[model samples]
Target: METVRIRNPGMYWDIAANLHFPPNFDASKHYPAVVSNHPISSCKEQTSGNIYGAALAKAGFVVIVPDASFQGGSGGEPRWIEDPEQRVKDYRDVIDYLQSLPYVDADRIGILGICGGGGYSIKTAIIDKRIKALVSITGVNFGRLMREGFSNFDPVGALEAMAVQRSAENAGASQRIDIFLPASVEQGKAAGITDIDVLEATDYYRNRCPAEGSGTRMLFSHAAPAMAWDAFAFAETLLTQPMMVVVGDKPGGFGAYRDGMEIYGRAASKNKQMVVVEGWSHYDLYDHPVPTGVALERVVPFLVQHLGEAAVSRVTKPAA
Candidate 1:
């Protein structure tokens, strides 16, 4: 396991990235690399990104995990701001850095995005032809989520609400955001898990993965409205690359996972696959070992088959 710091020349954000290679990495071999995107409000240290990187490294593929802009050690003003356009650019920026490396197979690059990062990854693949393959894990269609509340798809109403929130934010007023967990576990029970999957989500954010460096309480006042905009307008037309969508069977009612499958099904690329792990909940795909292994098993082979053997060696080799 090796950590590398990369500066995004285009965005001017200094990104902290981790690269995991197999025990026998050879400088002479050019390896295929998979760039893994972290979930919303998550840094590279989170279970979803690092666990996947470790799995891919063991599978003989170079895995690059980057801290999303405005989160963790990555640079950005107005911390926790979520901009669809900028997020997609961040993905491209990571690709640019990867392609510049001597050990990377430029043509065999792949991407894997978990949770909110999944949506950004899909959007990036649409515009960037350099991405040869994609994998979205329990991803969200952030655009739709912002425009419509969970279990409802009222574009007009959602946008109207966003407009109100944006107005307050622009007026220098603090905006209210969903608090997935309360200050105490007792309060969490009363809040009800309907708005959130308590068993999976609450446990991790509150007890498991709290923001420490900047402190995890990061929430965006303006970015919530930006999500209401249609980030996937070109989803059907732009993405022609091979894709894999993974989801948990339990608590699968979350609209984003279904939307991901719909997006993949409609993609211009003919090669695509969808997998659902039985009894797994949405957050289970992140920190828990069960869903993590299930996800890696599918993801590793997908990249190997698409990116080929030369690219795999780079991940397995030790750095010089």
Candidate 2:
């Protein structure tokens, strides 16, 4: 395994990344590749990106886990701003970098996205046909989610927040994440946001691998573009490749799990499957041993089948 950075001189800037090479990688022999995207407001190792990336490598494909533009190690102005259009493009930009490698089989490339990245991966596959296969582990389209309901189950509230934030920006004021995202567990609980999913997120951003810049903050101006795009809007026509959607046993009544299932049902792919890790919650599927283990087990075989002979990876089961 090695860490590398790809400089995007054309626009969005630098991508900080961790690259995992398959066992006994050879300089002359080309192998299949997979690019995994992390969650929103997350870094490479903060979510399932690192876990899944390394697991894919063990299964014989070279893998990369990257931070998107304007977040984590990637360069962009007005930090932590989310751009749905450009973020989808960022997946392809990572592909551009992967295709440049001498030992990578460009035609056999696959993409994996967990949580927010999952939604973006679907959006990317809709346009960028270079993505041969798609996998979304508990993926939710924030565009659709925010457009429908963001906080207090009010979609109108989210849209209004966007307009207000943009207006504030014009007036020389910037948005702060603390307003919607509590900085502490106590804060979230006090605000009655104590669901298992949010609590998991709080614990995640507050403790494990937190120093890597994983948190729940973003520029409110990021909402406008999100309000405009739909990750699965064209899946019935454009998303024709093999795809997999994995979620845990329980969705915890959060709309994300249901949204993920909807994405699966809406995909146009003749070859698609949804694997559920029984008895696990949404966050359990993120990084916990049992669920992540089940997810990778299903993901490797899916990639191996669709990515063709080059992706017939063989090493061992994913690490817990």
Candidate 3:
């Protein structure tokens, strides 16, 4: 586990990230690579990023988890802006670095994204076929949330508010307006954030595994553009890479009910699978060891199988 900066040439700023090398990792021998994408408003050091990256490394792949531009420690203007296109570009930019490393097999590269990152990874894999395999765990596309808002959320009203926010923002407004998060869980619950997904995540992100630059607020002005984008709009025609989308089995009355099934079906890949962890919600898989374990059970093999035969013969030995 080491912090490394991956420079995105001609971009706003370099992505601050962590590079993980497998145990007994022989720098002499090249290894397959896994690029991880964290949830929105999260960084590489968090439970979602670190846990997944470390787990994959333990499974014998070199993993790099880069903080999205403008989020985490990465650089971009008007901080906290969640530009979907830039987020997608961030993955490709990171891959640009991975492919440069002498120890990374360019053709044997895969990606793993959790939560919102999963949504972006789907898009990234669609156009950037350099990624041989992809895994989206408890995946979410903010396009739906942005366009429609979440459960019990009003898109029309939200759009109306965003229109107002955009005017103030484009005019160089400095004050921050948060559209989703409240200052605290109690406040959020009182403010109509009763959904278990937000509630449970509030507990962890606010308490358990929070870190620097892992702030939970997005600029209100970003609402309109974020809502307009569809994360899986192109999955059917463009997403042909081997894909694995993991969703919680037991519907928690929300996203889990159909969480990633749509994207799974939309993918044009002849090789794709959906894993449903029993009795979990979308957020449950973020840090919950049980479901995370379930996700790993499938993802490890899915990645190994698709990345290349070299990884299969070398690092991914049967867990004894």
Candidate 4:
């Protein structure tokens, strides 16, 4: 794997990405490629690049795991803002970069997104016909999650608070940031957080996996765009590409399980599948060997079926 910087044409920022090539990759031959989007507030070096990207490369696909703009090593102002629109646009920018390489087969490109990245991937596929296949692993629909998932905060009230914060920032106030996950499992327990996903998130972000430039916070003002955006908006008609949605059995406040089921039912694609890993929770799919392995086992074949496999790929089609 090699680190590369891709220029985002729409936003004029450099997206830092880790490009993974299949073993004994041949530049003389074109190969199928996959763009893997890391979870929000996280960087490529975490589960997306270090795990999924590397695994997909080993399975014979060129994989690029990119840190979303405004976070990690990517360039953007007022860093760590989770703008859903910009996130969707960044996928296209990554695809543009992939198309520029001679060894990449532009027509066979696929997208894999996890957590918040999964939601953005759905949104990106709706409008970008260039994306031939879509994979969402434990994906959350951020807008819905913000609106209905939280137990304490009123969604409208939260939006109103965000509006005020944005105004304050415009009037020379310091940028207000919001914590993405609890600092520790103990803190989460004290806060009455009983959701398995939240507890696992704290452990995952704080202990199990941590990477430089990956933070536990995001710009509080990011709520404005994120609250209004629907990752599955118009997916029934626009998302016709061959798709696959994977999620764990444990349902949590984030709504990834619900979102995955909804997308699978609503997608227009005649060729689509959904997989539920029985014993795992949402975070378990991130890096845990068993759940992650199950996901890759299913996803790699689906991708191979849609986007023609590389010369080195030995993955077979799923049983009908």
Candidate 5:
């Protein structure tokens, strides 16, 4: 994979991306492509690039893993802002970049999104028809997660607080940022946080597989926009692209299992399929060798089958 920058029109920032080329790549020949999106607070070097991008490239597809605006190597101000609208638009910009490449087949493009990105991909495909297929791994619908996860939940109250913060920041108050995960499992345990998803997320992101530029924090002002967003809104009627929803069978942790099933049941695509990896949790599917292997085992064929027969024949066999 090599680094490239894509100009995000109307957004005024260039998106930093890692572009993965297939083995024996022929620049003169057009190839099916996949846009792999990383999770919230993750950089291209995380699962999206190192795992999925590499694997998909090996399977004969040109894959681009981009750092979302305001995070990673991407250019944006008031960094770590997790605005859902911009996130969805970033994918469209990625598609524009992919379509501009001579080696990429514009009509045969697909998207693969992990964690928070899974939700953004769904929202993007709902309105953008260029995405021919979608593969959502451990999908988390952020709006729903926030709505139900909070105790004494009150979106209005949260928004009200955000409004005040925004006003303060506009008048020179310091920007507030919130850490998305704990520093370690021991700290979480001591804090009396028993949720397996939270603990595992801390372990994986904070300790197990930490990466540069993936500081796992977001601007607090982003809450209002994210709280109002819904990744699956109008999906049942508008999401017509071929899709595969992959999630672990485990119960909790950002609601991937529930959201994946919701996506499967709601997507208008007649060719959609869902895979629940037994015994794997949400974070496990992020980089666990066994779980990621299980996911790609199905994901590669799905993309190949949907992208084209030519892609099927070009699929590279895994090395022994």
Candidate 6:
């Protein structure tokens, strides 16, 4: 377990990353690599992404966990600005670094994105052919989520509001917006929880995954309301790479999973798969044990199959 700080030219900032290598690492052989992106508002140290990175490293691949642009150890101004374009570029910049490493097999690079990151990862795979495999867990299509709030996908008013905010933001006026927190668990107020999904998200965010360093708060204030609008668009025509979209069967994620599947199904790629875990909710797939296990089982095998035996074997070999 070692942490390395890498500078991202794409975002013009430094990214704090954790690179976990198997107990035995060999410099002579190039290892397959997987870059794991964390959830929104989370740093690389979050248990969910860390657990997955450790799991992949144990399976013989060198896992790199890079802190997303505006949060964690990464550099960005006006923290939590939620720029989808910059987020995707951050992953690309990480890939660029991975390719430059002598011990990494450039052709066997893959990615795993969780929660909000899942959408970014999907967008990355669609645009960057360099990525050989992708797995999105409990994914959220930022565009859809923002346009149509949870349980509904209506962008009419949200889009208009964004336009209004964009104007205010351009004019250097600080916009006033509501900040939803897990502590505000009084029905219909949690940040990412939906009526359809389990109601435990409030507890999960407040108690289980409290933010570390800087502030332990779970929500943000006035986070560039325009970010949601910039996160997604009609990207159906851009994806041509293999992708694996995994979502819990519960209500919180059903809509998102369906949306992702729709995108995956229409992709021109010859290889794509969608897996839904029965009796699982969106938050359940975050750091929750049951959903995480189900996710890892599907993801590890998928990467192996798509990236090829040679790549997996190379990464898994015992260090001399």
Per-candidate Cα lDDT values, in order, are 0.73, 0.79, 0.80, 0.87, 0.88, 0.69
> In candidate 6, which residue pairs get closer than 3 Å at backbone N, Cα or C atoms, i.e. clash?
148-154
Winner on lDDT (5 vs 6)? 5
Please estimate how well model 4 matches the true structure, expressed as its whole-model Cα lDDT.
Answer: 0.87
Model 2 off-target regions past 4 Å? 151-157, 178-180, 309-320
lDDT of 5: 0.88
TM-score of each: 0.85, 0.90, 0.90, 0.94, 0.94, 0.81
Per-residue lDDT tens digits for candidate 2, residues 1-320, read 78788875686467778888888887677788898888878778766455788788888888888887887877787788777788887788889999998778878899999888899998898888998999998887878766664544676677687788788878988565433346778888988875677777776677655755564677776666777778888888889989999987676534567877898899999999988778888777777888899888899989998886553333445999
Candidate 5 least-lDDT 10 residues: 308-317
Better of 2 and 4 by lDDT: 4
Report the Cα lDDT for candidate 6. 0.69
Task: Report the C-alpha lDDT of model 4 over 129-191, residue by residue, as the tens digit.
Answer: 999999999998877877776414478888888889899999999999888688899999999
Tell me the tens digit of each residue's lDDT in model 3 across 1-320. Answer: 87888775687578888898888877667789999988888889885556899898998899999988878888777788887888898899999999988788888999889888888888888899899998988888777766544523677778787778688867987646463555568988888877677777787687777788786768766646676787888788889988898998755433533648888878899998988888877777878888888889898988888875333323444988
| Candidate 6 lDDT over residue span 199-274, tens digit each | 4555566667766621322212333343354333545566666788888776663356666666666666667888
State which candidate, 1 or 4, has the greater lDDT.
4
* Model 3 ranges with Cα > 4 A deviation: 150-160, 170-172, 190-192, 250-257, 309-320
Candidate 2 differs from the real structure by a C-alpha RMSD in angstroms, to one decimal, of: 5.6
Q: Where does candidate 1 have its weakest 10-residue lDDT segment?
A: 213-222
Question: Candidate 5 — which residues are off by over 4 angstroms?
Answer: 150-152, 309-320
lDDT of 1 by residue, 36-74 (tens): 888766777775456787788778777788887776777
Ordered list by lDDT, greatest first:
5, 4, 3, 2, 1, 6
Error of 2 at 307 (Å): 1.6
lDDT for model 1, on a 0 to 1 scale?
0.73
